[model samples]
Target chain A: MIERTATIASTVGLHARPASIFAEAAGAIDAEVTIARAGDPVDEAVDADSMLALMSLGVEHGEVVVLRTGDDTAGEALDALVTILETNHDA
Target chain B: MHSFVGVGVFRGRVIGPVRHMPPALAEPPVGERLEGSTAPETAAAALKSAGATVKELLQERASRAEGAGKEVLEATALMATDPMLIKAAIKLVNTGTSAERAIWEAGEAVADTLKGLGGYMAERSHDVLDVRSRIVAVLRGVPAPEIPDFAEPFILVAEDLAPADTATLDPSKVIALVTAGGGPQSHTAIIARNLGLPAVVAAAGVTGIADGTQVFVDGATGVVSTDPGAAEHAAVAEWQEKASLLSVFDGSGRLADGTLIPLLANVGGAKDAQEAAAANAQGVGLLRTEFCFLGNSTEPGHADQVAAYKGVFDAFPGKKVVVRTLDAGADKPLPFLTDATEPNPALGVRGYRTDLTTPGVLARQLAAIADAAASSSAEVWVMAPMVSTAAEAADFAALCTAAGLRVPGVMVEVPSAALTARHILDHVEFASLGTNDLTQYAMAADRQLGPLAALNDPWQPAVLALVQATVEGAVSQVKHSASLETTSPKPVGVCGEAAADPALAVVLAGLGVSTLSMTQRALPAVAAVLRTVTLPQARALADRAVAAASAAEARELVRAGLPALAELGL
Candidate 1:
């Protein structure tokens, strides 16, 4: 599995607009992807493509969150999603 | 006709059949097992099918949605297609639970988890409930909970409405709104005014009125009548026709004697500015500056504040725009700005007083307004709220001058400021009376207290006396002072609910208020009434109103003088 950890950088965190954008990006990829707070258990991680679950995580700015993908070549997808998480959408 | 009373949200009259929103759906039975051995497998398939139906519906809605609605609907659609939610429901079904019960249980679990996270996530908890209801409705073979389709415009009757319900409502389809419970500042009233729909809120027993029963709703006087007679119906039709004609009058607000009153609108932010301008408001009378700071954890940056101020200023090119500085406190407490847990927040440090202690907060705002004004053709005038003393007024005017603001004014909301307005106006260029607060202070009533609402009448003799004192003070200043502008008596405008009342508006104008600013929906009625009365007749109405012993008496006295208000059923 390909996995990465990134701190949320958006002023409003991954909520409303940012969550939708992240979920839409994850949905476009051809691999299973999940996200959760860094220390959460594997089962607690939610489908990254589900905007509702991503928003329900309540990942605030400066909090470390993790993303995982089943495909080995999904490194590019993970990087793109991480960039969005680390950008301040409010600005 | 049997009648009930509420607080009128906006001035207009309409006759339509009552339409009650359907009550909330009953809870689906929990933990019920299916009939046979194939029940578990059958339940899982049904659950999947129901979820898909919900998914398809939400996806369709999302496709047509725009802005925030689009984001919310798309997120909801995602929820319907969520594999984890489906799996959870299936697990429940594996234990012989019914499909509807399993889906309900699964939806609640996720909703509770999100709510447990608190803050913004907790807000989305309601969205989970919305999704659950849609899926359950599909499983139960019933129509999803939504506004019923109707061929004709109808008066909407409801206990209360969620923000989403209001977002989906077509204003044209809603002839008027009547709610059993809500206040002037409630979402229903605010939305009704924003959409230019007449509304009456807090009407007791309004929910008891049967759907499809013909009724007359007078949003001006807050009267809801059932089985209106022919004459009452004709009166409503006449009022509606006159209102339409009044709305089309593009000419500026003036008295019968050709004395210009300059009707303006009280706007919260730029979003409302365009609406006010379209309503034919001469300019913005009160541009509240709190919108820029409300949601921010910290102070908004200079550029952000500048952009917000510029949006409003640009909307009123070549017109007088009076902007009030950040006036948050009490009912609108800001954590970054003040303590949210004050005992008596109304009397606590607020408005310009908070700006004094915070120092740079007001300075940054003034700088932003100055920056916005530099590029706009609008005649921008800046004002401070809740200023009680002359020294504070002088300090604020000095700050405005430092920031390059041409016009500096103070809101005479406090009685002390109104009584000592001559001294306050000596330093400030103008004074605008926020009659809501002034009435509250003058009558010793809390503005937000429902029971004390009666005491917070602007027509109260004491309140009018205070307004009279302020106007007379400003007149005295303009007449005596050599440094001040002598063209007009340092323009004093009424920018509050009082200005919305046609009779009280005339009294305010008669009391020497040079301008009247109110919610845009109320401008036409006030303007229409103003066109019927000469300046002298207005002054006489003011005199009769002020000479009365009580608010009710004062209102009656003034109402007697303005026979034109009878046509509008004021």
Candidate 2:
């Protein structure tokens, strides 16, 4: 499994527009991906492709989250997801 | 013809076939378990398909909408297609819950979660619940609750329309508005007046009138008469001719004897100022400065205030622009300036009184107003609201002088100011009668309460008495300063909603009020009515108004006194 850490850049946090943009991008990729607050328990991770799941995590502005993928082909997909999380959709 | 009576708002007359607002959705039945309902798998499939269909529908609408509206529809569409919702619903269904109940429970759960977040996130709960209703309606084959859609113009009848319900209301397609519920200050009444449509509110039985039923709505008399015959048709034609006569203002206000009453506009900000200037208002009488203070956690700096005030002053060059200082607290509480938990804000620190608790705020605002006035050619007059005592008026006038703002004024909103008007006017150059607040203070009625709207009217004898007192006091101030024959009577202007009423404007003129400022749209009607009567005739009407026992009686007496008003269809 490959893991990456990306900080939320959206001023309003990982919810609303930013979360929707990130989740849509994640869902389009061909891999199993999950995300959670960086310091939280690994088992608490939720599917990254679900907009509601990403929002329910309540990850706020400038907070860091860990993205993990079990699929070998998901490296590039994880990078794309990280780019979305770090880009401020509000801007 | 059958007739129903309610309070009239605005003096418009229209006749059209009625169209009732669509019925709201009923709460769906829910239970712990599905007894003979569809199986879990079948229910899950149905839920999925319904969600997809709703999402598709919303997306299609979003494509046609623009700006914030399109964003809202798109966000709501996302809520419909949320996979987490289906997952939660299936989890509920696996525990023997019916599909409908499961969906509702899941939607509620998410909405509750959003609400708990508070502020911006909390507002999204409404969208989630809306999506839940659409999905449930799709499953049940029932049409979603929405605003009625029709091609031809029709009079809209409703049971108190909420903002959400009127999102799809096409204003152009609506001839007038009739509601079974709501007062003169209610949303329905206010929107109707703003749209310049005939509106009658608080008419209890008007909603029961069937769709496509022809009805005559007389907004002046608050009458909704059904099955109009020849007389009503003739009245409508007469009204149309009179309405045309109540035409565009010629930028001047005069009595039949040719006494000029400077007709000014009450503007909120720059946009309103520009519109008022275009409408040919003599000038702005009440430039509410709340736009600078409202929404700010801390006090706005001098530069921010200057920039904002400059936008308005720039609109009316060489015209009178009366700017009021930050009138915060009471109905308009500012976070940085007011106590949120005050027992009775209306009676407590409000308007000028806010400065007692937070000093330097009003001073800073005056400085800003002075700065904006310096660069603009507009004749800027500054005023303080809620000034009661001569001492309070003196302090405000001194502050204005200190800030280099000439022509200082005080608003006669409190009863003490009206009762002791001569003393208050001694301290300021001008006094403006704020009839809305004066009525509220005199009648001891909350202006916002629907049941108290009758008592809160300016036509109330007590309120009219206060107006006369203020105007008389201003004239008395002039007589007291007789040593300087060049000095004019301290002008007492009626800068309130009452001034918008054409009949009341004439009565105000009769009472010796020097200026009349109101909503720009009402300027022409008021100007039209004022030109029909001489100053002496207006004084006779004013005397009759002051002697009436109640608001309704006084309004009737005044309307009757102005026979030309009926000709103007007011």
Q: Judged by DockQ, which candidate is best?
A: 1
Best TM-score goes to which candidate?
2
Of the true contacts between chains A and B, what fraction does model 2 have? 0.26
Q: For candidate 2 chain B, which ten residues in a row score worst on lDDT?
A: B115-124
Worst 10 residues of 1 chain B by lDDT: B447-456
Model 1 docking grade: acceptable
What DockQ do the predictions score, one after another?
Answer: 0.44, 0.28
Each candidate's lDDT (Cα)? 0.84, 0.85
Q: Which candidate achieves the best lDDT against the true structure? A: 2
Indicate the docking level reached by candidate 2. acceptable
TM-scores of the models, in the order given: 0.76, 0.78
Task: Report model 2's TM-score to 2 decimal places.
Answer: 0.78
Residue-by-residue lDDT tens digits, candidate 1, B1-570: 789999887767888888887666668676677667666877788888888899898889899888656877887787886766778889988988877778788889888887676545655777778888888888888767766559898999987665667868987788899888766645677678767788998898999998899999888789999998887788788886777766753648999999999999999898799988998899999999888886454688999999999999999999999999999787666645765546687888889888755779999899999999998999999999999999999999999999999899999999999999988998998899998788878878876444565676677899999999999999887777886546567878899778988889999989999999988877888888999999999999999999999988998888888888877665
